[model samples]
Target: MSNSQFSEERFQQAPVVGILRGVDHATLDRIIPIYINAGFSTIEITMNTEGATNMIQKLSEEYPQLNVGAGTVCDMDDLEEALKYGAQFIVTPITNEAIIRKCKSLNIPVFPGALTPTEIYKAWTAGATAVKVFPSSQFGIGYIKDVMAPLNKIPLLPTGGVTLENIADFFQAGVTGVGMGSSLFPKQFLKEGFEQQLFDHLKAVKSAYESVFQTA
Candidate 1:
């Protein structure tokens, strides 16, 4: 699929972007199916990961059902490399206007990280699909709520310190989506080779998200 074809509708079905960082190819191969099976629609492989470009290419081709993206894109070179390898979306840890503009020109969905109001507004004005509030754990859900009060027009995707327990609460606070990393896929499970436990955890997370939207 083309990079411009990111499905916002499909993403809203789950609205959780699973982040993979420093994961080896073998581990990625083992866990992707589990992630997909647990009802995730979006996943990003950080550019800093070893062989990230290759992994993006392979996953994009292998899992057409998944919205394969590249994260940790801090500069123009990283953006070029990600696009060259079929990254359907782009994510950054900082608000890089050049990278955001490039992704915007290509019509690829981009989420640039920001914290303060100034940075967030700057990223939104630069044409980011959504501004990611990085290290959100530092301020917690109340911070997201306060930011949304005035900047309600800007879509926010909070990353860092997100967990199944608080995922629903984040949505309630008016976030467009949430990005999860080690919280969703615990390092302990991966290190110990507890595949079944990890799969179960993902399923539980999905259930928790769905519960928030379920009709009474």
Candidate 2:
């Protein structure tokens, strides 16, 4: 599917994009199914993590229905490797026009990170699938509201600062979705056998999103 189609589908169902940073092979094998079962349609595995590419491959092969993507992609090499490993989408921590264009050329959806309005606009105009507000917690709801007031046409995803308590507020503030990490998958849930606990936590998070977005 095209980036727009993938994003639209995700928006229609679940807008939570799980970010697995520093997750190893074993941890991924344990948590991936849990994420899918919890109703997260998209996941981003940071490229800097050890065995990230391998993990991406594993997730892509094991869960072909999920949108497995590459995150923290800083350069072309990372993008190429991610695509080779079957990354369905691409996300960068910084607004790199070159990388965005490259992904665009390949028809891969890319969410490049940006902080200021200038950076966000540049990334959006450069063809980013959507602009990710990095360290969004630092900006707070006020900043997000202010930004969206003017750039509502561009889809914004708050990454870094998204918590279970504030997910609804962020969505209310006009974010297309969120990039959630520790808040959704804490270390305790990654233990040898925490499937039930993990599922319960994810269910709560999903509840929070549904309460606000009211997905059918």
Candidate 3:
């Protein structure tokens, strides 16, 4: 197993990391394979998603080829739970030096959130696999591009507000990858009446991403 230390060699090959935020056990059972089938080798189930740790353990056990990561992990307890659940990577909405060091102690890759150059650099020096530029919608892709100019050595993952139309724009602006939420997963999927629409959204987002980021 590659484990979630997110080694450079493995991460390079993993172009997209699917951020699954609104899943339950049944939803996970249905949705995880969809990402894998769409050529996404990495999947992140946020703590906001119900049964995150249990789902992580289940999905990791079932999908040996796909690397699994935990998102919205806020504390040492979450880190410990993630490790116990066999998560391969850890993600947070904000940078926490303690979480970073704790994950390092267990050899798990930690990608913390940051909005400014100072925070990004601090996260990097703290040993994050990459820094997640959260709420990219509000910050804009250009801001991220600008941030990368001075801190080019740090790898950035832009979450929130990156869509199929602008996903490549983020890449062009310069980000290692994007972590998408509602834009990829629509409201109908959560409701009972629109399963087929969910399928369409999945294919549309995946296809659009393929068209937009062939290099990925």
> TM-score for each prediction?
0.96, 0.93, 0.87
Instruction: Give per-residue CA lDDT, model 2, range 1-216, as digits (tens).
Output: 222223457644888789989877888888888888888789889998999888888777777668888899999999889888888889999999999998898888899999999999999999998899998978888899999888889999889878878888888777888898888889898888898999889988888878875652
Runs in model 3 deviating more than 4 A are 1-14, 190-200, 207-216
The residue pairs that clash in candidate 2, if any, are none
Candidate 2 Cα outliers beyond 4 Å, as residue runs: 1-8
TM-score, prediction 3: 0.87
Give me the overall lDDT of model 3: 0.78
Sorted by lDDT (best first), the order is 1, 2, 3
lDDT of each: 0.91, 0.85, 0.78
C-alpha RMSD values across all candidates: 1.6, 2.6, 2.8
The digit string of per-residue lDDT tens for model 3 on 97-207 reads: 999987777778788998888999999999888899887889887898899889998999988988877776777766787787777776567555556666666677666
CA error at residue 25 for candidate 2, angstroms: 1.4
User: Per-residue lDDT for 1-216 in model 1, tens only?
Assistant: 344457788799989999999999889889999889888989999999999999999999888889999999999999999989899999999999999998899799999999999999999999999999998989899999999999999999999978988988888777899999999989977754788999999999888877777832
- Model 3 error, position 124 (Å): 0.6
**lDDT at position 100, candidate 2:** 94
Q: How many clashes in each candidate?
A: 0, 0, 1
Superposed Cα deviation of residue 204, candidate 1 (Å): 1.1
Candidate 3 positional error at 93, Å: 0.6
